[model samples]
Target: MTGLSTLGRLAPLGAAVAAVAERLRPSVVTIENGSGAGAGVIWSADGLIITNDHVVPGDQARVRLGSQDVVPARVVGRDRLNDLAALRVPREGLPAAEVGDSRALRPGQLVLAMGHPLGLSHALTLGIVSALPTDDDERELIRADLALAPGNSGGPMVDAAGRVVGINAMVASPGLALAVPSHVVADFVTHIGEPAPWLGITALPVVLPPDLRRRVGVAAGLMITAVERGGPAEAAGLLPGDVIVAIAEEPVRHPRHLLEALARTPAGGDLDLVILRGGQGHRLRVAPARRAPQADVPPARSAA
Candidate 1:
């Protein structure tokens, strides 16, 4: 019968989903930080875990492993802007999640989310990729039409193959969730201890004139307001009032875009800056310096 045939075809899919969930449960962990509990993903065999910054705001927390074994975890690094934190546990040979290329993901792709929802452990949810970052978007987030709860933050969003493509960060709205892309997490892990690169300039977003916009191929850019004395921008002969159109070929339409581009560049690396001054487009090569550690100074509105 038609109904029987449909059920027969769906049986394999249901079995496959079960198998993937079983395989990935070991990599998902429950993190308790006194405020509440959330989930974390085992990122390495040597006990490196990744979770949301808000989950582990302090330097220490407890991680409940798949075996129900509770262990002490240390917050090794935190990137609050991206809402991601890296934790190290005193354990070895853990089952690590397979990281997938989020850049390869397309809208409508089937995805799975695993977490501890509402005190229930190892809960799984089904969903699909709803959208991706656009040129005007400020942050790189994976938007999903997935059901997520308070306890789902810091969990892994995997593809059908059980490879992690994103880290669930927050619920955007009803029936909508936003996740930090896996590629961005990889970059954060790579530069965990390194100081963020500094451009030594303050800037604000400004709309480009119609003729300049058509010529530059962008509608808006960051206008440099001040150049630090004897800094990279000064050394590169960059003056205030210059509009930054792009950095290393990546368009800069807002201050956040400039900050994101600078974060991607390594300290002491050469930056290819495309700028406009006096209605003329120019390219400048500036070597960014590593920002020195400072106290709780408020982040400047500029790119640095």
Candidate 2:
């Protein structure tokens, strides 16, 4: 009798979840690349698909529509900074997912994670918004407790109202699923097919120890893990293992801050950077250059 009552109480909630899944199923798609397959969401009725840059590693990928139609899709744009990429397929009258403001999301709010996880087609998982990245993070990644798998990399995280709020991007340790907020996705779509300035470096944000923090006069800094040869960063004398503490007098604590500071410098213009190398500080001026096409240059890996 108690089990029957508990089942009765959960029936409405189960039905509501099922309804949302059915509503967003058509807009979700399977994106297959040379590496593997992931999920993507249709962002426009004219066949614009939004996915993760990691999902579509190269310039093009194969998109499988809901009707089981496989078509070759071109990479319209990829913003490696935010881990979001857009694709264009030759089709019309497609179902577009309704995007919602991620800023409006509250902690503990019910959300649905839709994706094709572990080769399973059209999988739906439930969870709540665990946390939102602080302003300093810049990427606006949404942290949720949703169960995610390898194939869920580029799917949509929809709200109870069936509005897409974020795109599943990566999962962190200790069971946290991260997604790129919809607002960031919208910005990437706005500048689709446009290339941004590139400062060829692979960096990771690191927190300095108490003594080092006091010595560097900052709490955090970006550790230059890799400096591209013949690139602007290398030209500026930025070597691997150097810790960048500031840019043009502004303290840079994260990769986003460094990127924003670098974006302010025009092509061929100098950006004064303060780097701590070997327990000493050195100021180096770096000039950023316009990024080349996907075929010409390697993408700088900075997201961490």
Task: Give me the candidate number with maximum TM-score.
Answer: 1
Q: Give candidate 2's error at residue 118 in angstroms.
A: 3.6
User: Best candidate, lDDT-wise?
Assistant: 1
> Candidate 1 residues 264-300, lDDT tens each?
6765578899999998889999988886422221223
lDDT of 2: 0.84
Clashing pairs in 1: none
lDDT of 2 by residue, 1-304 (tens): 9999999999999999999999999999999997899999999999999998889888889999998999999997876777878999999999999999988999899999888999999999999999987856646689999999999999999989999999999988546899998887886686575566666887877778899878767887888998888888888888888988888788877777776665556666877888988878899887777764333222233622
lDDT score of residue 154 within candidate 2:
92
Write down the RMSD of candidate 2 (Cα, Å). Answer: 4.2
**Candidate 2 global TM-score:** 0.77
The CA lDDT of each predicted structure is 0.88, 0.84
**TM per prediction:** 0.85, 0.77
